[model samples]
Target: MQSIEKYPHYFNSIKEVHENIQSIIPEIAGAYKNKYNLSFPVDINLIVGGFGSNAYTYRQIIPNITFALEKLSPNPDHLRVIVAHEFGHLAQYIMLDDAGMDWSKSRWTHPLIWLYREGIATHLSRQIADNIHPSVYFSYNDEGVQWLTFAQANMIRIKQAFMEDFKALTSEKLFHEWFSINGGNRFGYSRLAYFLGNRFVLEYMEKHGEQATIIAWREENFEAKIAQWLSQEGVDKSE
Candidate 1:
């Protein structure tokens, strides 16, 4: 309420966002369907104010994507990447559910789980969206200039700190420092974990192949494998 009141222009593009987002949803979803040969019903909902994310996926008997128009970038390329990223999440969840993944037992609280989730989605966004500037795939907008530069330069340091946090920090602290928008105490940039996740997906795909890496969530030793990957040195150099 306060944000809307003070920064009315923040949501001034709501109408435009609504039109463009509705127009692109099917196109991007179709590309994903064709790429993976997996088609599933998805409900795309647009809202004025959401949980502060530009977009996210939620499943309640069916998969749905919610776009907070105010948080979104109206640039067509950014919209495609963001939408495709959310659908990438849908593809991941559907694959796991089809494999009989017990949602109750899944390690939802683990940071590495999130790393894989965001990593694969970011990877899929890069593939699904038409050729755009590379940083758009990660940050989904032009505003990511600083974030991209920092992530590229400090990849190894970030991984080391992330691994240390995995062993030392609680889930809440880990997420805040790495994943949340308000994070970045160490590196002065939030959501650096997305960069980490992308690297994980890339390396894992190189080692195990794309199909296996996509469904690695179902593997019995997922945690151990991710831990081992994290413990290794110079994984950044591979990229």
Candidate 2:
């Protein structure tokens, strides 16, 4: 009701987003299934007027995915990238579950865990939905040039700032600063940690190979390793 009242002008655009999602999700799901060589059925739910999340994975009871149409763009490329991104999450969960990962032991509350999860999902989205403009993977819109450029130019400073927060032991504010849409006080860009996470995943893949990087959180020192990456102590700063 509030969303309907707040932005009545966007209702038509939201409807178009719904239509685009319906048309494209099957193809996106098929691509991910083939790329990962997995046969699980994809369950997608369309929604509106929620908490402004573009899309999210619901892992309780069953592996279900939902997209908030009002929070998404009507562009087909955006739909493909976001849909594949959610499914990327599903793939990560299923792979770990099938491998007998102990859910009770997982560090579900840590910032590092969040970083790795989003990073791997973002990375997988680009791979499944290949050869589009790079900004789509991060921004979900064609107008994300500024966001990407800012993040790329300030990699060292961002990583160092994150490293400081990681060592502070105050995770609630840290998580919001890095991951939430409402945060930008640090660098004036929300979800900058998503970019940082993707960079960590890319480097980890280069060093440790694919499967290991996907399940890197399983190791006990996962957060420590992520902190080390954020420290960037001796690493090259000019990229």
Candidate 3:
């Protein structure tokens, strides 16, 4: 893909971002290698005009790896986190393969998959970025500022609940459901999905290694397994 000099002027130049993203790969791989003990190819693409100004994994038959950025040099700390997060996904994907996941036939809605995909990156990204909140960030502000208002509220709740407890926020069934419900374009829902998935996996990491977590995430019935996570878990549902 031709490099679109479209790196938002509010951030760094495309060339700068390209260098940063490229240079971080070895450090990223090394971090996970020591933590999870696995290796995977990391090929990222710089794509703007995406639904999110975040990094994500591109799934293909061969999984041509990708990690997108909303802006070239969005807050340096955030950029570092996003890159590390996407790289985390690459690492987890390799772990999933080692565990014999049947990705080609998988439905992709598995909640555990959400956690594995979003959480590992989240956990690692926070570290690389030296972030205070391991899985959350704030954008805008104000009530009429719909996105900021909601995110701020969610952040408060997350810190009170998930940040401390973690298990209370972990759920496979509701993860994808929230993804669809909050994702149309109307704001905070989709972003909330990212943090939810991450928090769940960060907790999972404590109990399971990367490979085991990936396999569990890819399991066909995790959504069903996590069916009652919301109503019974006791995290404010008033969002």
Candidate 4:
């Protein structure tokens, strides 16, 4: 795997943050490979910008993993969580490819599908970081901890709220409602899907085991399996 670093002037001004990322790259990559079983070479790029701290994987001639280092906590542990989460996406893509599935064909517009993808990544991130230490896994940042706490505390309510709207909504409508800032906030929580998805993954892992969960995710009938699991748990999706 190859790595590239690009720091904005402001980012370069912070010696610790820059140095922390440099120090953490190998650890992140090592954890990713050992945990996720991903062996393909990926181009990992770190960029400093104001667009918000997020990571994306671009599959072109090679898999390009890019992380935007804006609005991120300077804490190295926090950065590790972000890196692990992003690497989860890369792992997902590789798994899909191995399963003879095209990542481009993923139904991003579907809220459930989007939730599963993000949730799995979040779950993997937590697992990867926890392998180092429990504190690093759980207390990466205040907002993340708060959001996760809120999500867990209100999981049933969130599921009920989602079920109430899932039937009548189209994929596009569902995506907008569940993922968009204004739409997400309408249900008294924003980005609820991330938490919900994480819960879903956790449930699956609890029942099926981690490697099985990953395999299930790669299968074409993954959503159907999720729906069945939800039904078994009495999560009503019918109108």
The most accurate candidate by TM-score is 1
Write down the TM-score of every candidate. Answer: 0.92, 0.91, 0.62, 0.75
Task: Mark the 10 consecutive residues where model 2 has the least summed lDDT.
Answer: 230-239
Which lDDT tens digits does candidate 1 get at residues 1-239? 67557446665567677778887888887898788876768667888774377787774424788898888888888999998898888888877777777677678667898998899999888889968887888778898887888888888898889999878999999999999888889888999989988888898898899878888887775978777777776735422
Give the per-residue Cα lDDT of candidate 2 at 20.
Answer: 83
Least accurate stretch of 10 residues (summed lDDT) in model 4?
A: 230-239
lDDT of each: 0.82, 0.81, 0.50, 0.64
Which RMSD values do the candidates have, in order?
A: 2.0, 2.2, 7.5, 6.4
Model 1, position 74: C-alpha lDDT score: 84
Give the CA lDDT, 0 to 100, for residue 219 in model 2: 76
**Per-residue lDDT for 1-239 in model 3, tens only?**
23334334424454555666666666666766776676665455665544344444556423555555443343345455555666666665666677777877665644435544565556556554553442233221112245434644564454333223334434543443344433424333444555555545544555876446555756766654433342133433221
In model 3, where do residues sit more than 4 Å from their true spots?
1-12, 47-54, 67-70, 109-116, 127-190, 202-211, 218-220, 235-239
Rank candidates, TM-score, best first: 1, 2, 4, 3
What is the alpha-carbon lDDT for the whole of candidate 2? 0.81
What value does the lDDT take at residue 167 in candidate 2?
A: 80
User: lDDT value for candidate 1?
Assistant: 0.82
TM-score of candidate 3 relative to the true fold: 0.62
